[model samples]
Target: MSEQVFLLPDLGEGLTEAEIVEWRVAVGDTVTVDQSVVEVETAKAVVDVPCPYAGRVVALHGAAGEVRPVGQPLITVAPLDAASSPAGGEPAGHAVYREEERAGSGNVLIGYGTGHGGAGRRRRRPRLAGVDDSTRTAPLPAPTGAGATSAATDPPAVAPSSPGPAALSSPGPAAPARAGDGAALVISPIVRRLAREHGVDLATLAGTGPGGVIRRADVEAALGTAPAPDTARGLSAVPDPSPDNGTALPGAQPQDPTGGDVIVPLTGIRKAIADKLSRSRREIPEVTIWVDVDATGLLETRAAINAARPDQPVGLLALLARICLSGLRRFPQLNARVDTEGQRIVQSAGVHLGIAAQTDRGLVVPVLRDAQRLTTTELAAELAATTAAARAGTLAPARLTGGTFTLNNYGVFGVDGSTPIINHPEAALLGVGRIVDKPWVVDGQLAVRKVTQLSLTFDHRVCDGGVAGGFLRHVADCVEQPALLIATV
Candidate 1:
């Protein structure tokens, strides 16, 4: 028998290490090629690392909750069919899965070579051995409409065949699934982890998602900790302190035993944000410019367009994005990045605009590709879809990268203005504040009009205050008289 070791491949986005969240397989279990054997949490997102070899698992390198560096041993498997081996192979029973031999899932992590339609393509999940076929049932067909399975219903059992919870190698505290209950129809590893943490029975809860898939909300609700309404939009509140108990609530850190201060560990998405913001502050020399504009015309223009379409209404952010595109056309310098290593400016030809969004996973900026080419309606649709994916934590890593400039609508936080930090490597960021009724001098008379603050924070290395001021002024002009867009649109 040939024992092949599977090394932990790079999880991409320059991440050096990952915390092993859970192991889906255990020693002595049979696994297929491209099967997800381990789940790891990186700085940005949680990812599933698929095994490249097909064989019986012999050894696991790391325990759950431990951090493993890239290129280290993750698992060892003994090939089921070894008699067909070549005459000359690696030294006695210590073989590594060669690059040519791997047939990986097409969802390739960066730096890892991608595989074609070999064992990588989607296929039916293999059933576990020793599990009776009668107990193993096919997954239930998804309900066609919402609330199809009412609260009165016991929620039908549509379990598929899996290795069961005992097969999972989790040293961390996690509730195991009951024996003979059948595998829960769960797709997300995060949801499973949350359910285990709270000791909630996955077999009991009815899935509200498509195809009877269980979502995080159902688990949270089962735990009796109602998620915030903003959670749907991807914004969640951070915990501070409790008056009576002196202990923080869930998602909050506990106070130190010394009775001095609370110690919150910096990790995951929060740490990533901290590192990027610090680097941006240390390396780039950024300048901020602001202007309070009369948005009366912008609001009226939106109302008129929505009235005409009625069904497909344009959002204010989309109109603002349209204006930003026009201004970038006039001042293309803003649509660029500074290359410190090459000691030169790297100007891009097209605008890949990044919209700053606050998600449950912290601040994530989803990029809209070829922003300059898309119409206002198209831009609106892209913005909505990207934001929704961000909230759902389903956005791909590629969508989070390759941004030329960023547009931050911090008005959702009810703030009037903010001198925001520029997304690293990007040349500029535009901030839009809340629009409110304020006194304005219009047509030589005092009038109450909708006014909002627009701030531009830009890299001085790419453009001086003159260019930055010009871009901000053009945006303000468009806000005051949206008809100015007709010239370019």
Candidate 2:
């Protein structure tokens, strides 16, 4: 028997690695082509890998919840001998069955390629149907046709039989003999994890996944109980007063007397984020500069613009991006990075601004390449696409690379200001804070005016405080007088 090795494919995003969320097969088990053998979760989405060979499983390289790099072998299969081919079966080494070929074949494996001659693709296996010979043991009842008798009134066509040891030990339902054979329960990894953590029985929870597979929300809903009080409180509510304070209850137990609490292992995007951030900090020499801008005029200008085009309104970040691009033109030094290894300064011809967006997978910076050439509307569109992709974890590797500078908008989170970190290889970064209405003396009389804070952090090696200040002042001017951007652009 020849063995075939299956390696993880590049999941369309050019990601170098993925986490093995779950495995549907084990060693010593027989599997057919196109069967879902494993489910892997990349930064942006979860995908199921189908087996490429039909044979008994020989080895598994990784366990569930383990992180594996791309191109690594995920599973191995040993092909059956050509002489042992079932009646009418294609000769051994003949191309494995494909879905298109299953149309004519009567015997088909569930979740695998169709039978001998174009059989319909195997149906997904139901969860409760025991793994071994489930199809044979619990085939779906025959449909009632005009001439057909109901299963209830007629003698059963099939009888229940003892499943082999391998089938009984399998994790999911056994493959069926034909399409529409039986209902298979599908569940997501997140839903499964939630169920396990909450001690909810998988059998009791109805799947909401594709074709009525169980989903995370469905599992949570079925549990009917909220996460532990501590978990919920930690996520949203403010901390309670210390016990030493007068507000302390007399008999309240102290929080987790143990110094250490639960520890969740880092994997997937979170792991990628930690690694990148550490590399940036260690390699880049950062220097931050703050400018308290008189944003009154800028705020008024933005309001007027929004009022004029209510449907296609521009955000403060859009205005900030224009300013940053304009400043880059004025202080070209800020647009250049030090190439120490090359022994030269590498200055980019155009500005590609990286917008730092926070997602469930931590921070991802998607680049708006050539920001200087884009109009406000175009910039907004790009921002929307990048952010949506970031949140979805589907950003291409190129989109996350090649940033000449970065802009972080903390204003949306209600933060007044922050000294943002420079993405390594980028010379500078700009932070925008929330706009507030404050008292200001305009033309001698005190009046309420809008104000905001701008923080710029740069590489001192390439840009001095004077240049940094000048770039910031230009940004302020463009924001304060919105039309200035037209001339600068």
Q: Report the number of the highest-TM-score candidate.
A: 1
Q: Candidate 1 residues 1-489, lDDT tens each?
A: 569998888776777887665565667555656666776766766666777777777888876656789899989998865553334422222122112211111235764423455543522222222223343322222222211211112222222233432333333322323334444446555565455434456666665654344567777776665333222222234432211111122342222334554333466666888999999999989999899999999989988988998777678888999999999999999999988889999989999999887754578888998999998888877877777666555665667789998998887666899988989989999998878899999989999999999999999999888899999999999999999999977
- Model 2 stretches with alpha carbons more than 4 Å out: 9-18, 24-58, 69-71, 78-260
Estimate candidate 2's RMSD in Å. Answer: 13.2
**TM-score, cand. 1:** 0.72
- Report lDDT per candidate: 0.67, 0.60
How many Å off is the CA of 330 in candidate 2? 2.7
Write one digit per residue (lDDT tens) for candidate 2, span 309-352.
88877666677777888889889899988898987888899999
